[model samples]
Target: MTEQVPVTSEMATPRRRKVFTIGAALIVLLLLLAAGTTFLWSRWTHSISNDAFVDAYLINVSPQVAGDIVEVYVREQQRVEAGQLLALIDPTPYQREVALLEAARDVATAALEKSKSELAFLEEDVPLAIAISERRLQIARDRLAEMESALLMVTRDVENGVRAASFQVEAAKAAVVLSEEDYVRYGALYEDRSATERRFEVATKSFEQARAQLEASRARLGQAEAQRQRVPITEHQRDAARGAVEEAERQVEVARLRRIEVDVKRRAVVEHRRKVTEAERAIELAATEVEYTRIVAPYDGIIARKWRHLGDYAQRGEPLFSMYDPDFVFVTCHLGEDKLDGVAPGNRVSIQLEAYGEPFEGRVLWLGSATGANFSLLPRDLSSGEFTYVIQRVPTRILVDRDERWPLLIPGLSATVRIDHGPGDPQWVEEGLRWEDRAAHLSERARD
Candidate 1:
């Protein structure tokens, strides 16, 4: 070793200053690193998902009627508008069915008309019959009253005549007796010569006249007795008239019951009307079937598949093609459960489509309440045994921005999604990376 010289104060002071500066710089670097790590960790708030796909409403088109395919106006990958005719089934059979149904309807309508006409006739006839029967009943009642009154009058007159005739007969008998007595006295006087012959002759004549009067009175009394006997016959006749009145009343009731037939006919008309309505409905159904021969697009979409061709036999409800509406295209992403705390609807999202190799603007439109595993064919059954916990993922819907200038995004396209959770700009991550690169360079320099 060589002999050492004594150190100066100036040199020692400069060395101390240099050591102090290095220590200060190290402390500053350590503080910067701690601050940078904390800032970066705080800013790492975004949720990323690569398990995403573009989705749309896939529509399955089918024929409503079964028939041979007659015309096909669209093919695979064809763009079509809503209500555009896609194909047509053979309409001959449906047309025939419609014709048959229309004929049946016509027959039903004619039958209904006939029933109505018959009902109308009965409607008039039933009341008219009832009226006639009632009038007959009234006439019978009137006749019965007349007969009764006549019977009463005849009875009274016969009784009074019999009484008068009996009195007359009694007086005539007395007169006859008196006349006979006078005749006998006159005869005696004539025989005895106590009176003249003329006087005796007059007494005889008076006696003969009284005897004749007595005979006439007897005849009138017999006639009066016969008339009194006929009074009971008149009563019997009145009773017969009363019976006639009762019969007439029954006839009126029978006529009223006869209207029930008209009611039955009305019911028949109603039944026929119901049948006609059924026939009309059948016709409507036939017409509907005829209309169903033509298949029309349900919405505006592109035909992704075609399952039938012209001249191919198709059945009802058979799927003919697959299509979808373009207006509702969106991305479906599966997000981790832990990542959902910051993701919500209306948040802006970044979508990277695998097919286009570019990013597109999107938004968080919807989020599923349950994870995809819950909806899978074999869901988790924790109750079966000991379990390994899995951080389930929630399904989220991202609506891609619709821009005609951009490429058309179809359904089922694989896409990556990055959802922005906070208002922090994503560019800041890059800025932080740049800051890290500068810090790393500075550290290397410090090491060197």
Candidate 2:
């Protein structure tokens, strides 16, 4: 058997102390590993960003029409409601314009009515007058026909009277010749003592009677010729009747022309009515301009800025005031691209307003597709020689619950936000999160 070595208490104590020191080092290392694991887990469960601010929709109130401001109703930072009168422009000019337009429209309406009445009168009376003229023309034509027939009958009577008078003249001439022959023969016989004185006297008396009869026949012929010449007078009367018919026809044509003129007047009345309508529209436009002289609030909000005052001249599209709704306030944060890996809308978030000194709860409402710098008025050029790669931050919108306590929290307030990336309570996350929860969290932090 090997020689047994003698052991000392000091050596044994040293060995025991070495084992104890190693055991203590191992325990410390295990504790450090556990702490590192916990820290990493916490980091993985939370996404934090300091680049955020309270934001709201800002409205730039401007005038719809140009005018001098007569009254300003609110001061800077004053609260107002929807439809509240914020300012008033000088409405005297617009009012006067509306009045003038109204008067003009009334005048136009009266003119249109007059034209319509005139047209109606023409419509009613013109046709009747034309009918009467046509009837007159027909009567004139019939008169002409009667006169012409009378002229033909007079002409035939004149011809017959002329023939009868010529036959009487020829018979009287034969009797006168016979009487002269008898008178001469009786005178010769008496001279020869072959006839008596009584016989001779009878022959002379016969010759004288024949001469008187011849004179009567010639007078009758002259009278008959005068009657034949009178036939031309009947022809003259027929011509006069023809002229009357032509005149009547002209009158009828004039009546027809008057009817056409009436139709033209009807068209003129239509045009006047259109003018009246245009005047009415002009009056409406003037009224609208008058109404535009008053500026009213569009929604409930506090005035953030006042750009105009009493006596200020406001122009269209010029800002008179600036305002934002307090109840609609939210946080706009720039989330780093690396932090958006698992982030999405509806993520639970905690907001800490530097002004409020409290944490407020909110939920992600929207996520942007582009970086903030990309939307800047002047974006950085990546191709420049001094270009350096920069991490882009995406803009994220978070909706906060309305809280009466934080009524002063408006746009542009500094804030920090932390979003929970771990499994969240569906009831609180899905249904809604209260900003009051942030007040409670503040209380808890204060207690701690």
Candidate 3:
């Protein structure tokens, strides 16, 4: 309004170009200094590795027994708790096997009980039978002894009777001879009238009496000889009694042998018990197989993949699903061996996930004992006389801190991690600021 100078486009253009050139030069210089400072600060204070990724222990859930999948309780990406039922295999066959084994076990148990009962009866009966046989043998021995004693007495009595009978026969013969002589002399005197008739008659009667006495003595001697024959009969009876005693002794031995049979029966009982035990074990094994038909989650995790569906035939040891624990996610970084200096466990870490905008905090969990090359499938064979030196990378584990957004991160995600190796603020102080607070602070600083 007051004396405005008319500015030409060329003059204004040159002035603005000068200002822009100066500003651009100053910005370039500042960028160079910032780049240098950043490079030096990074080199001195931290180790960096781009060869990194979020990692976790991936589990391939499988069945321990083969069967048809009867039920599916989860889908892919389903979250599950520890011991939650994931699937079920057909349990009919396993249950049937268990029932069959149980029946067999019952039969075996019954047989075992029967064997035990028989053993008990024999234990009592066998000894009693043995005792009876021993008693019978003792009785037979006593009878034999009595018979022998009686035979001995009979033998002595028979010998004495025979001797006495022989003496009586000799005396009767002498008396008969003397009485005949006297009767003959008296008869001759009577016939010649030197004696009376009554005297002759008396002598004849005396001779007859002597002859009767001799006949009686011979009968007694014959009776005594008959008694000698009875001695042999008694001896035969004693021999028979001795035979009975021997037979009874044999019966006692047989009874004792029956005791051995009892031992055999006891062994049989033991065998039956063993069979029963085996059957019980078989039943338990079948029941265990039945339990295997129910597949449960081994731990709290999320199902990453599902391979078997309902009505599918699942083989033993075949994977049914894949899973991983979200809480256990960590970053595995392959750092250059030279960058490992000053890096130790519990060092602070900054992790930037490819799928997330905000960075996460972490701490060093451990350092690997071997280089990546050592675990390569096709390792270099230095024995071929050809070798190349390579800068090896060491694996380092970083345990990510838990936050509300941590569950969004998954395994196998690309990540960039910076591990702080220099002395700095305590971890608690650094972690005190939430991501929102940090972002707000950065915005404020930018405004300043």
Estimated TM-score for each candidate = 0.78, 0.76, 0.86
- Model 3 gets an lDDT of 0.87
| lDDT string, candidate 3, 1-448, tens digits | 6998888997799899999999999999999999999999998889988889998767788888899999999999999997899999999999999989999999999999999999999999999999999999999999999999989999999999999899899988998999899889998998898988898888888889889889999999999988999898999999999999999999999999998889999999999999999998999899888998999887778899999899999999999998876766778999899899978777899999888899999887677999999999998788989878888999987778889988878889998888899543455434433432543443333222
Clashing pairs in 1: none
- Output the better candidate (1/2) by TM-score: 1
Best by TM-score: 3
Instruction: Give the alpha-carbon lDDT of every model.
Output: 0.84, 0.84, 0.87
* Reference-based lDDT, residue 319, model 1: 86
User: Over the stretch 349-425, how does candidate 1's per-residue lDDT look in tens digits?
Assistant: 88988888668987776688888997899987888798997888888877677676344687888888988885434
The TM-score obtained by model 1 is 0.78
The candidates, ranked best first by TM-score, are 3, 1, 2
Q: In model 2, where is the ten-residue run with the lowest total lDDT?
A: 439-448
lDDT of 2 by residue, 1-448 (tens): 8998899897699899999999999998988988988878766877889999998777778887899999999999999997799999898998998888888888888888998898889888899989999999999999999999999988988888888888888989999999999999999998898999999999999999999999999998888889977788998999999999999999999999997889899888988888888988988888887787878777777899999889989998798998876766778999998888656677788999898777888888667888999889999976767877788999988878666666767789889998878444455544434543543343333222
- lDDT, model 1, position 165: 93
